[model samples]
Target: MNEDITRQLREAAEAHRPDRAQMLARVERGMAGPAVRHRARPFARSGTRVALAGLAAAGVLATGGLAVAAIVAAPSPSPSATVTTPATPSPAVSSPRPTSPRPTPVAPAPATTLGSSRPTPPTTSPSPSAGESQNGPLWSAGSLDSRSTIYWTQSNLALKTTQPLTSLTIEIRIVQTGAVKNTGTWQTLPSDDFTVTVQEADGALVYRWVLKPGRTVPAAGFEFAAQFNNGTAVRSAAGDGYRVDAQGSGGSASVRGGFVPTR
Candidate 1:
């Protein structure tokens, strides 16, 4: 047929023949297995390693005895790392000082009574008695009598009472300035025990006194007076005034005033 197909491809190319010396010994053992695993990791030929931390200073690389090159000086932080020192001072204590007591020396009183009158000086008492009354415990005082004559003028009041008065009155007034009438009125209390009067009213000269009915009033200091005339050389009893009202046995009192002006 084409010479038996060219003799069956030359007998299958002489029955397979490709050994080239065993494929060049298996490609030289696969390139000597990565060059013996890269020379067994001999620092892998160090020339680029820098993983630093603190205090280290290596050097070595003039270049190439196997081409290594380390200039590591990278780590530095500890110039005295954190130095500290200085501390000292403590001492000061002083407390405790308090003592008081000493006063005893009196030997002269032993002559006790050679004249013992010095001790009699301890007798105090009797204090309260000021005037101007309003409700009870009475005491009074009014004035204007220097024998007052810049034309007449009398006025006086006095009163005192501390317990026996079954009701009383007194009045007095005056104020009218020029030739003011009413020239008399008086009382140390019993003129028949009160009920006196003088009159003229409102622009003034009043007088009054009153107490008669079984009449009582006796405790002490009495006086009452009035007398008038007033032709002024200096007579401004500034609206005169006097009022009294008593009722006692220690109770209702009322004193009032206004006539002062006697030099």
Candidate 2:
């Protein structure tokens, strides 16, 4: 049995033995086939490259769409910046305003006349009847009736001076039968019992004394005489010393009196 098995293996080896030339030819064909396949591989790889390029193009388009969408969705600037731009011009338009015109100047009316409206009547001179005698130790001029009773007198005397004096001293003598029986002294004429109007007439002060009900006057058979005491003389408007005119019984009798300066 061992001999039979050895013989079969020897036969199979001899039958399967390759020819050297044929073996070489077969290896050469196999090498040429790989060279042809290697030459055609570039065409297959070109299709794969086209598919990768399409995928890359799709990725790029998606990225660009995302960028555009982000730009459209973003918010604008704040409202404060828009408000501040218009506020800058508001103060500029309100700065200049129109000025109003000043009122026209007016002149005052001319000065009107002073004091009472009624015109002052001219002073009348007194006329004395005959048989009337007026005498005094200090008498300068004038005559009084010795027999005429019921006499009334009025006098408006004015005194002009360079200096201002507060008051005057006047001496009144009561004469009866050509003798001074009683004497009275007064600081101001007309006293407080009479209505005396004192005013400036023609730039000189004039005192108006009316012998009304309450004034002093002599009774029947007596005469009233008056003169300035010492240091009472003043200048007159006629550029002379002080002078006075007295009218009695409603201009029925009158007397002119003069003042003699003491110093």
Tell me, by TM-score, which candidate is best: 2
Candidate 1 residue lDDT tens string, 14-39 = 44444446555655664465534444
Cα displacement (angstroms), candidate 1, residue 10, comes to 66
Q: All candidates' lDDT scores?
A: 0.59, 0.33
Which ten-residue region of model 1 has the weakest summed lDDT? 53-62
Q: What number of clashing residue pairs does each candidate have, in the order they appear?
A: 0, 0
In candidate 2 the C-alpha lDDT for residue 218 amounts to 31
Mind giving the per-residue lDDT tens digits that candidate 2 earns over 1-263? 97686555545444443344664564466456544455448877787577557645544554544554444445655577444444444444565667878878787532111211222211221233211224221122223212111221111122222222222222222212221111111223335644444443453333334455534443222122322111122212122122323333333222234322211
Alpha carbon lDDT at 157, candidate 2:
24
For model 2 the local lDDT of residue 80 reads 75
Q: Indicate the TM-score of model 1.
A: 0.24
Clashes of 2: 0
Worst window of 10 by summed lDDT in candidate 2: 178-187
Error of 2 at 29 (Å): 33
- List runs of model 2 lying over 4 Å from the truth: 1-43, 78-210, 214-263
lDDT of 2 at 238: 26
TM-score of each: 0.24, 0.27
